[model samples]
Target: MKSLDLSLRQKRILHIMQHNDTYITSAALAAKLNVSSRTIRNDVVKINEELAPYNARILSLKSRGYGFESEDPKLIESLNQIETAFFSKENRARYLAFKLCFAEEPQNLYDLEDEMYISHTTLDHALRDIASQFSDHTPYIRLIRQKETVRFEDDEMKKRLVLVEMLRKSWNYHARRNAYYDDNFIEPKVLDFIIDLVSSNLNKYNILLEDPSIVFLNLMIAVMYYRIRDGHILPYEPPIPKADTSVYYACQDILNTLTDHLHCYIHPEELDRLYLFITANRLLDQTTLTRETAKDYFGPNTRLIAEHFLTMIQNYFRLDFSDDDDFYITLLQYIRTLQRRSDIYNEQYTSDFVKNDLRIELIIAHLFQPLALQYLGKTLTETQLIYLAYCLCGTLENFVHNHPGDKLNTVICCQMNMPFLFAMKRRLESDFGNYLNITALLPVNIKNSFDFTDTDLILTTVQKPITRNPATDTLYMSINMTEDDLARLEHLILQRTIRKIYTASPSPHDLFINAFRHEKTGHGDPYSIFRDMAADFINAGFVTSDFLNDIIRHEENSTYAICPGVAYIYSLIPAEKSAMSILTLDHRITWNTHKIRVFIMTCFTLEDMPITFRLANLFYDEAYDLPKIKMEENPDVLTRYYLSFIDEPLTP
Candidate 1:
């Protein structure tokens, strides 16, 4: 019989049908698979067609549902084979990788094809996928195929790295700990013994290991033991210069215990690699390490790297952390530890603390990638980037707290008694004291004569003032300020304050009016739009002739879609003059994964860092209605709408 070419889901449907003597409804199957009932019905039709040659079919009864009917024993044997073979492409690749890595000799193509119950073509495709995965995610390893055989060709250390990464990907935190006793890759007895031994030795040396690190360390030990026992020893390379820290002594003790108990002659080169691994994974007890004494624990270059990192943050994000000793110490410690194992990629994990602000954090992290590569000798993984972002977030919070920008100068007019008016002034001060500076508290009758020259906003209690300064915005509050009134007052204060920080003589409004361009129809892709925008920027003398290519190159490295249906693409290199070009499309164009309608391209000088940062924050704010702004057809209307986020009233 020919091999049945069934998908993993189709094969699963067959298995579920074969095990049941009675008919199984599509609803039940769908519930089991967590798919739609319609999908189950479609899968049944495809499965029946594949099983037809073997004189087997799944019968569908109107009310009774589907039943498996087969007389040929060959059909049952094929179903059993399907159960034993790998189910999905990912699993098949993983199986092939493990077989090749642990094999004593190169694996024959024919043998692998037979063992995997797949045709030669399928196995070849799987091999290509494995190679691609390694190339993209783990650059240190390679999958080599020579005619009719295949094997992994790379450094032994990198081979071990791949093995540990595969194991880590296969199991979660709790599952990994449980795998210590239940995994078949390593003997349960040996794995349990190694974990207990490492735990005891780490404790004996007064070293602390977190849960994830403990699991990772045990996996490393297990992989090293099996590989070394199989005659795969790491070659000796001269070690990098380093201080003899306490973690080094702890690693020595752990390895010495493993060597004596496992009865295997471990190589010294492996010991150095293991020490680096332990040092990278070790957590410092902050209570024991003070700022004055922490310098003693770090390498000489750590301080320089930390200072450079802070300087980059200050220069790009306009956040200064010069005097933040705690942030400085924290960054120094992270740099010292991360530099030790920078070559190892830990992209499989992410910090849960940064989910809400991941986009901004990713941009910040991308900005620092070059810095990390220059100092640490490797680009940071996503997980490490998130850790660095966490440090930046801490510094940003401190900077904002310490330096609240210029407060909004305001005047309040109320039509009540002096006592009640005084009470209202106290309320505004108590609520918005950080953002609002109340210049005067006067009666409603004197609103016309009040000095509005320096006022940023005018708040009236009874009615809207008729003769207020045209440039100064006004808000009407109720006599008894409701929750809605207070919320609106707070929002207005924030808008004015942000405007004060981001706007200058040539205001954002003016810039928008000057650079605004409208496209009634969009092109097939984002590149065309980028080209046109680059032409406009060059004509306006805002950027150089190579600005288009520069933006494209930056976009390839990092695509920024600040919000849904909007993309904010910019160049890191300083331009001739700071300028922005807005392009609004009537029809959406594909940008990365989003169908973007508004493209805001900016070319800013180093002096305009604050404006760049402010624009990013404004577009990313949840309260800013981007869809409404994009819907406006007229350029003047759209520009006003986009910049009028401050004018939008607060919703209850």
Candidate 2:
């Protein structure tokens, strides 16, 4: 039998076919591999040629596409080995990283080129790319390529950290298959033992950790084990704070067990690091702890930082959280945990279910960044920001729920009979009772005389000439409301209620009317656009010159390309007054990862925070027609198009 050499894509196709008992179509393979059908066919031809000498072939049937067929056991085993080989770029990178980290001395560049079946330049590029990826840990860990030799040098602990990150990234990819047993770095039995060891110790100590946290701990421990066995150990002592006595003992036991199993003396410094890791990852059980009692568990600094954060939130968003003891305790616990493990934990573990709320959470998190740096002594990582955002979102929900007066004072104006009106009222209450306070159910005929001064929203079944209050928003719906009507009404209620919370008085129409600029051709650079738009606001007396620098700084920290072709940028520092500016371009410019043609810039006062949410929805809301906004040439027409989605009445 001849040795079969296959390309990465070919091996992938075979791997997929091996897992699936039936033939897969060329179109399906193309879609999975993100390639053209012609490319898949060409690859299949080459794969077949490679397998011919080994008495194995990829068979293609009419319409059914491709399948692998083999009668020889030795051929099957060889194919399996080829499938498991490090052929993919990501896998190859991992292999190189592991090799460099574990190498006894500098590896010859020529030798690596031959081993990876690549030219000298290709080998150099791969090593440089790896080095760039680990550039953040520069002094602590490095991939040094001196002359024609390559080696990883620096702290053993940093090397272990890099390995853990690589493993975590790989685990994320493999975890989707529900099998980490196939991981190449650690033996299956050793990985299982490490997981069990961590789990059992936590169980014995009455400490709790989320599933993802447990997986992270297991990975860290596995990496630590391998590094220790390879004669690499933590050289310096990490400062260990006084953790829970039980957690301390648990970590001690884990290290002792590993030391005995590996027959290697694990350094005492490892225990300190492990203690911090376990404490940082542990979850506090459902038992509620008051502020005074929480201090005892999380330390006094945790309470101070949590209080400072809540105060900042109140001052910034005007939503008070001082009374929410549970929120305070939760924030304190999170801060304590964050302070301990900020260095080790970097991967994003936020669940996908919260994706809908992520936009708002991100805004809140960005707003809290300065305070996080001030109080926590370090800037929050993206993952930490997300975690903090989730906590704040919960508090915001509580604030909204607790304040009944904040709900929109709604009135239904319909020309239907008494029973029909009553049924409509019941439905509105059933659907939007949380957001709407239905104050009246009146006939449309009485619209001339009815006072809407107290009402925040007016839902009319039929469009009738009525004397309406400027503050009260109006929505037209069918007698029997459709799903679209319900959805629109829900959005209106949410926007109106949030505006009420933030005391936002300017309607969407008013906002656009204040500052709407139609640029025939926008500058190619996004920063130039920002500066130009900021000057317009400054000239109009809505903001000072500092607004330009403020927006630039904010964009640097958190870039918001809300949707495709639309970049929403706002100042973190509230403007001198509440104002908005919309700059539309005939041509698109690159903003972050998005190609943006529309820039919605705002310099809103602190009280106008909810208006930001409403503006954000102009892009986020699917019904708003982003393409229409992008394509419209006239500023007045564009403004009207934007106002069409909002419940605010248009000016004649």
Candidate 3:
């Protein structure tokens, strides 16, 4: 016997039956699939007749509309699989919409609706259904429902929490898919409803939430969210609103608790303006919200989230500020006017260096604006700006702190020519006014390359010795000095020795030098180094052990000389998986035939595409120009250029 192909309505009914655990009503199924109840009833009958042999049948009891019954385990399993696939598709649609809504870019609702293959009205209904699962109200706080928006109101923070929880669940469900979405879409609407409720209470009852600034931030985040959805928000210029001192205090309390457990003080102030600036403006509140407001969303017994922020700041930045402090006042007013206008604080000073440089155009837009209008807030104070820069640099520094120095590969070149040692002392101090361990060596300098074994990378322009101790997995090198120049060599080695080398991974095309010369006596080259010193690095396990054969090849090939005073001897040799090494000889040497002393021995495992100069005329930016040069001049600048990059972490 042949089987009959099911109608679309029958398929829809069967799909719903497989998915739903409870009995489904004909009217409900009809509503879900946008068909008449009569049509759904007929479809169920047809399904019963055709699927009888498969042990699938619809049962209509007294009050229930319809349900599928299948006692066979195999049939139930098959149905379950089909139901799972159907819901997965629906979950994906909702997830995409939510992600689009939360993103900091403009969103086209129509476009997304089309992509999901649902009519605009249908999508609206579905969103409302989702919203209903988390809606509630209180005095002066009603669940605000728009054509395409839904959010929570007073005393119903649980509803808000539920909504976010649902979103999180859906997010996780979709994460394993090829295309994933974030939570940007839900945050804006959720925040909007909360703020509107607060605003209504403030206007109607004249009862301000205990901590309104936080509420205001929540409103701001909503606006920022919308702006991002609409593609109007700027990256560097994020929204900034004043945070409540009450909230900051609450954050501190949480941090205190963590400290009690961890025996480490977490600074509360670190959760200040800078941190707020990074969130989308629309994700914040327009009016202040308080612990009372947080009760519904977090549980009634829950401590305010502000407490967590405070704890985080204290732990991260070691800053502590009270609600009544001047800093608190400054922060509160700033958040209020940040999005709408820019009148909070004035820009105190503009650096001549930053002002004249056209490269920082986005920064310029930020500077001229008021404290409340610039990205997040008005342009950061000169000190604040510099501090943030230092922070950015410091993040890299920390990455360098975990490994042996000899195993490092890439060298970062900057104008200062000092690896992990930049000339931003004044700027760093001004920005980090509170004072921190800023002078500590950047992480990259103190750590081995990304690998944990060695910091073999040299971050200087001076020649250093290639010495090592295997027992402790340590490398000792005298840079920019030779056996012949004992006095100067000792001083150079003292400065070159990084007290701690941070561990960092070598980047693509990252060059690791075994030796480098700081001054331009013009004898830096791979082959120029005495063979014994080169042999020392190999024996110490700094250079690839197979390099001996390559060294012989380099010696035979044109003396491996690159220029008058420079030489480059390298090999594409593979090493053991656990091997970690980098060594350098920075001074001039009289090799087998070459007299050049400047040398760079690089061993790289290329991970990116090689350079293609064929389209140089069209490509605009060439590979060579990719190297950054500082705005300075010196007689031996070129030598320093190469040496200065030795210790710097590779940025690109």
Candidate 4:
């Protein structure tokens, strides 16, 4: 059976009907589609041909609305396939590029130019063109003096963004190819020059480009260099120039020798960049010279590069690295890049300061060596070192009365994993000495400790627990355990909590009351103290029409308070603004809302809805439910009891 092409709207209509089997009213479909009933009818006719293969039917119901039914498995499969293909093109491109860049070789333009007839001027032009390509991303990438790199800059945010894009594009390019050399595209030398130019500039900028995409870009650069060195492969049609023997021979010799040296694949584009860099630096002659001589000039310079990175991390974040990689070489590379380009440097410092800092980082790592050994499982990475130091420093300040105390009382409840908790504990004591007692709880135990009321502070792993005690006034903290871990955790937490839940009704009554609970024990809303502030208004005769109007005006400009569920509706004339309250009914009111709920509402004037929305987000962080927690079986009573807490007497 031939499949018909369907528009997105058509597909949406089909999808809606497929799930809503039985007679569905035309009005209901119209509502879902945000169109008129007549429009829905028109859509039905348009989709009829596409649905014909499945013998599908769109029927109207007296009650429910409009729905569809079909028996054709083939049709469903075809629709699914169409959907997949329609959405996957962009993803595939991104994924391919990421893979290719990482798989390529790492080399300079001089080596690549040795394999080709390209003049220095041509190579320079190609490099410049590639750099120009990224000009649009200038908000994130910029050209700064080579001698004046800083660790911090006013535009740090933009720089990070550009670095991310560069790495992403490079990775995408590499993930798509294995060999760079083929007669179907530009010479590998050209491409390599472009890749290297971008990469070197990126490095020079001292941008911390730690992203998975970097690996891909690196790989793409490598493979492309190898290909171009091996042979000329142009992808464009015609206008292909035949290579001169002398030029081809030079390129071939350089390519062959380098390939053997590099061991992995090298793309032609990388070769181009190598040639440009070597030629620009007078390193091009080294290729023709003895192998050992080339080694001296082109060796990995791993330590020097590594030191450069260590210096950056220490200055920007005020953290030191112990030179640990632990399966994080790619991450390390990115950090080094960020350090080099970050505008944190001041003219006051000498070269010795940079070297001394590297030495200090090395020394710190050695100090952490014994402490890290305490953890039986898990390898350490450089990123973890900083976190460990912070934990130890905070602990010492809190627990230690004097310098160099003995036997730290660190209880790691560790809602976090053992490795993170252990590393943190180690770094703290090693750096600060035993001046403190630290207890870290994994989230599971942290929740239990809430029951005890004994823990001074709960070091939780999860962000924004569903319940927190307000009376105790516990301090909340946000800390980064590792570079990637912090970003991932923050993203996951915010994504779940910040996005509003669209509902058809108010939260169940039980949920409303439970939402106010500081813990299992009940209390008036902690924010109820604002009522005293309100009392001052009443006693001063300020709680009048004029006062209410003032609040309304204030709300017009900015938020009055943070109210989540129970909105306080106030207006000059309640009747005039009563309709404003209707906006609150997302769905018909449901009676079952419980403790794991969002609660608070403050409505002063009809116009304050916008203000309400702005403040609604303040508590938004607290509403995310723990997936592990189950609802109680006595849900109805729980709901009623929860609501009673709010409706029940607090003062009388």
- Number of the top TM-score candidate: 2
Each model's lDDT: 0.68, 0.69, 0.36, 0.36
RMSDs, each prediction? 11.3, 8.2, 29.1, 22.4
**lDDT tens digits by residue: candidate 2, 4-97:** 4766566666656655578888977875664568989998898778777668778899967788787774344444433234455655666687
Off by over 4 Å in 4: 1-135, 138-219, 222-254, 258-272, 275-336, 339-621, 625-652
Query: How well does model 3 score by local distance difference test?
Result: 0.36
Report the candidate with higher lDDT, 1 versus 2.
2
RMSD of 1: 11.3
TM, every model? 0.66, 0.72, 0.18, 0.24
Candidate 3: which stretches are off by over 4 Å?
A: 1-40, 46-55, 59-97, 100-106, 118-652
lDDT of 1 by residue, 1-652 (tens): 2446676567567766776779988977874654568999899888878777678889999978899888874345444333224667766887787777777678999999888899988898888877866745664577777989888885687778777766655243423333111235777578788888888878877777666567767888999999999889898888754464666777777778888988988877877877776767677777867667867777778888877877876786566688888888878867876776633334332132232255444555556667777886766665666677766664644554467556667788787888987888888888777666788888878777767888777778765543446567788889899877997876665455445545353455556767747555556678888888878878988788677876775565445542355677777666777777777777776554445677778777766645654566566553356457546445566567666753442221
Better of 1 and 3 by TM-score: 1
RMSD of 3: 29.1
**What's the candidate order when arranged by decreasing lDDT?**
2, 1, 3, 4
Query: Candidate 3 lDDT, tens digit per residue, 1-652?
Result: 2322454345556655755688878766764654567887788777788777777677887676676677773343333222111133345434543443343444455765766676777656655544443332111223354445443332222322333343333121111111112233435445545455434433442323323233333433344334434444332333334554444443344334434643543332333431342222222342444433434323321232223423433332222323323223223323333333322121212222222221122121222223212234323433333322322232222323322232233222122335424443333334322211232232333333333233323233223322232211122223332333333323222222221221123421232232332333333444334354345456656555456665554344223432223333444343221121222334445553333433334433222101111111111111122123212122244334543433343221
| lDDT (Cα, 0-100) at 109 in candidate 4 | 49
Best by lDDT: 2
Model 1 collision count? 0
Pairs with steric clashes in candidate 2? none
